[model samples]
Target: MELNYEGFYRFVRDELNVDLNAYKEKQLKRRIATVMKSSGALTLEDYSELIASDEVIRNKFLDYITINVTEFYRNKDIFTDFEFILRDYLNRQFKNIKIWSAACSIGAEPYSLAMILDKNNIKTNEKIIATDIDDNILKKAKDGVFKDFEIKNLDKKDLDKYFIEKENKYYIKDNIKGMVSFKKHDLVLDKYQKGFHAIICRNVIIYLKSETKDEIYKKFNESLVKGGILFTGATEAIYNPKEFGFKKISTFIYEKI
Candidate 1:
């Protein structure tokens, strides 16, 4: 039941609409193998066919590939820069502050933003809209519960202030939960929401083709309020900030101009 390469290519086009040719062969193969094993399928071919024909398997495949493995404050330095930008914007004193945590996995990124804003006393009618393509991860994010290890890297004082221990696991305080909206959004297929003061989409686009990245950035550009910020991963920003209607606000932050 090993996948026939030719048959796999056709399934890619018909089901996922992702041309395997665009992905690095070894990487794609490894991911398929991993999914096959996780799904208890005998072969990649069986897994692929199941995902192609079954709605449940299709969603499960998307969830698996979304690869929502993450923890709170995954990189502290990045959050340092993020805090600076958030404060500067807050200091400018807008009527409203709208932030998007695109591809937010298991609640960390948006919750991080929420914690920052709450701690800073950033005064405004402000909110963070967190979105991800996978419903499973979205549900997890909504739950706002994490293990102790997940928040270990967070600033100690901030951690104490924003989270509480309940039954030996960490849970985001009620304030943080009420400050953000969580939604299921497929950035590869869904329309971008507009007028965001900032978009944090770290490490989410590396798997996508350049054209898809560009298309998403174009949508992001339009969604911003002319001078809004865009945050990508340290290794994830490939498009020139200028051409994307953004100027480099920092090594990992972009400002729409």
Candidate 2:
């Protein structure tokens, strides 16, 4: 039989319980080819068998496809803008705010928010919800350990205040770590929690298809209350925000209508 993507897609769906079809076709195909070559599999069938038999290979495949690239306060200037909005607007509007850091990778984004909340003394009724589809990544996030580079963007004062440096690795303080809660969540397949004062979902939907992106945006709009904030990635801006019941409040920031 000729090597084809359809069969590989089916194998992934059945075995992994992940919907590969939600991602962009070209990107998904390229990732599959790279992983297959790395495993020394000449055919897709062989690769599928290898993944099924080896737990490590299965995890490796999942890790590669999930895209866990993240850093604390990624895009510092944009984060400053978010801080301004949170302090000047959201905090005043809602007495006890609720925030969701969707597709939170390695706890950086949510922890970043936690630090902001701590520094500025923002009151939240509940812990910030940080979620990702990959269980292994979620485990690492819960551990709250980071290398020098991961926390490089953070300033010295915040670093000293929020993290403990031991053996050259920074460990998040329990106080800040306690502010955010990590959970396993698949953005495409899972249900979104509602009544969020602000939802930060950045740098993720760019890898998905347009329809999938549209679906996620619609769901995000639904998930937020009126006038709630939707902070998206720099590259993932909604050109026609009105269609999604949002108005462009700032660069990569939207306010729900």
- Encode model 1's per-residue lDDT on 145-235: one tens digit a residue: 9997788788678778888878889888888899989987877666887888888898767777677788788888899997788888868
| Candidate 2: stretches off by over 4 Å | none
The model with the greatest lDDT is 2
lDDT scores for all predictions? 0.78, 0.92
Q: Write the per-residue lDDT of candidate 2 for residues 161-211, one digit (tens) a residue.
A: 999999999999999999998999889888999999999999999999989
Candidate 2 collision pairs: none
* Model 1 residue 139 lDDT score: 88
